[model samples]
Target: MSLSTEHLLGIKYLNKQDIDLIFKTADHFKAVINRPIKKVPSLRDITIANLFFENSTRTKLSFELAEKRLSADVINFSASQSSVKKGETLIDTVNNILAMKVDIVVMRHPNVGAGVFLSKHVDAKIINAGDGTHEHPTQALLDSYSIREKLGSVKGKKIVIVGDVLHSRVALSNIFALQLQGAKVKVCGPTTLIPKHITSLGVEVETNLKKALEWCDVANVLRVQNERMAINYFPSTREYTQLFGINQEILDNLGKKIVIMHPGPINRGVEITSDVADSDQSIILNQVENGVAVRMAVIYLLAQQIKR
Candidate 1:
């Protein structure tokens, strides 16, 4: 079975079957990556271009690694160093790349709908690495995959996405993906940081961290995006930490082990403490490992649609 949509622009575009297919595909790739000979020749004839209009560490490296693991020829582009600096349009840049016969475009951009826009105009397949504060589909896929790995399944799991709801692409994607797979989701943070229309997506809002933790079987903590904040959403960093940060003390008070997750570049003390992040309950590292396999599955499946 294949994904319903050709381009993975967002989780909102995917159905339950599509998600299941990705997870099933990832299970196979996960085992393949664990083997001594990690490389595969699945896409040896195909070429993929990674276009990053924004800065990334994990997502960028993860995609590059996934592409190489599948034996796809990879081209990496950074907007900061490219002609985008000289005011080149997105289409011109991509059209130029497509001229070189790139089969799939995995892109991360600061603008929302960048992937969707390219998919309409470009000949190649599209994968949205991230698009503004809109969505990060693969990240969400890997996140749900990690949850399933730890908890047996994503169905009926209670998940709380804590911190910076307004600015996080991860939070939005996770909400859509998790709900599609039968998990109940909640957003926990300061009222100002939480989007006003988020509850319309069928997720509840919890302002109190402790109560949110009590209600959730898993907490997917998000970092405080100071760079994305235009104004003071809360009084101060210390205040936000005091109210929303997850520490060992808070986990101990919960009386049950709730799985901890953080999509990386974590603020050590602002969103989660180092001890909690390093604890056995935290699957942050597993999420990173699963990221590679999940990405390989995505690229491999999309590459199947390419007519060689």
Candidate 2:
């Protein structure tokens, strides 16, 4: 099955078939990346522009490496150093880049619906790296990919997402992707940080960390998004950590092996401890390693739709 859309705006826009196709494609790229010489000429003649309107380290580096592996001509753009700093509109900045003969546009913007908005006006294919509190489609895709790699299949697995759900693009995207692939999902966090309507997405909610950890096949930990919080949701960092933090003690108490995941820029002692993050049960590094292949699958599949 082929992707039904040209742009990957969000997981909300994808179906089970689309996800399966991406996974199947990613499997091949994963093998390719493992070889000594990892470059592929699938997108040899294509040009890609990565426009990040927000600060990023992992996502930016991951996409660039993925594009390079696929042999696509890549141009990187940061909003801080661009015409956006001079009051130029998003559309104008993108159009100027596209005029340079770019074939695909991958962007992470501070505004929600930024990818969707650009897809309406731009001629090139749009990939949503991320958007504000909206969705991070590729991250979710790689996450599922990592889970499948570790556990053999995503269907029927129990997964719990912990921390900052209301403000996390990763949580929203993962919920959609996991549920689509038949994984049971749960969100655990402080009441204020967990959205009231999160259950509408067909996932259970839990405030107790111990219960959530015991009930899941995997616990996907998230960092506290201090940048997104306009006002104090939870009282203090110490209180939040004491209440919800995952450490060696918590894992040892569980008495069974369950996968641990964290989308990075981890808060060492806050959300997760250094020991747990580096433990045998942790697939945190695997998630980062799989990101390139998953992104390559997204870019390669979309490039198939772009006429050379």
Identify the candidate with maximal lDDT. 1
Q: Tens digits of per-residue lDDT for model 2 on 137-166?
A: 999999999999999999999999999998
lDDT of each: 0.95, 0.94
Model 1, which residues run further than 4 Å from truth? none
| RMSD, every candidate, angstroms | 0.6, 0.7
For every model shown, the clashing-pair count is 0, 0
RMSD in Å for model 1: 0.6
**What is the C-alpha local distance difference test score of candidate 1?**
0.95
Q: Quick one: how many clashes does candidate 1 have?
A: 0
- Cα lDDT tens digits, model 1, 75-180, are 9999989998999999999999999989999999989889999999989899999999999999999999999999999999999999999999999999999999
Instruction: Give the per-residue Cα lDDT of candidate 2 at 76.
Output: 98
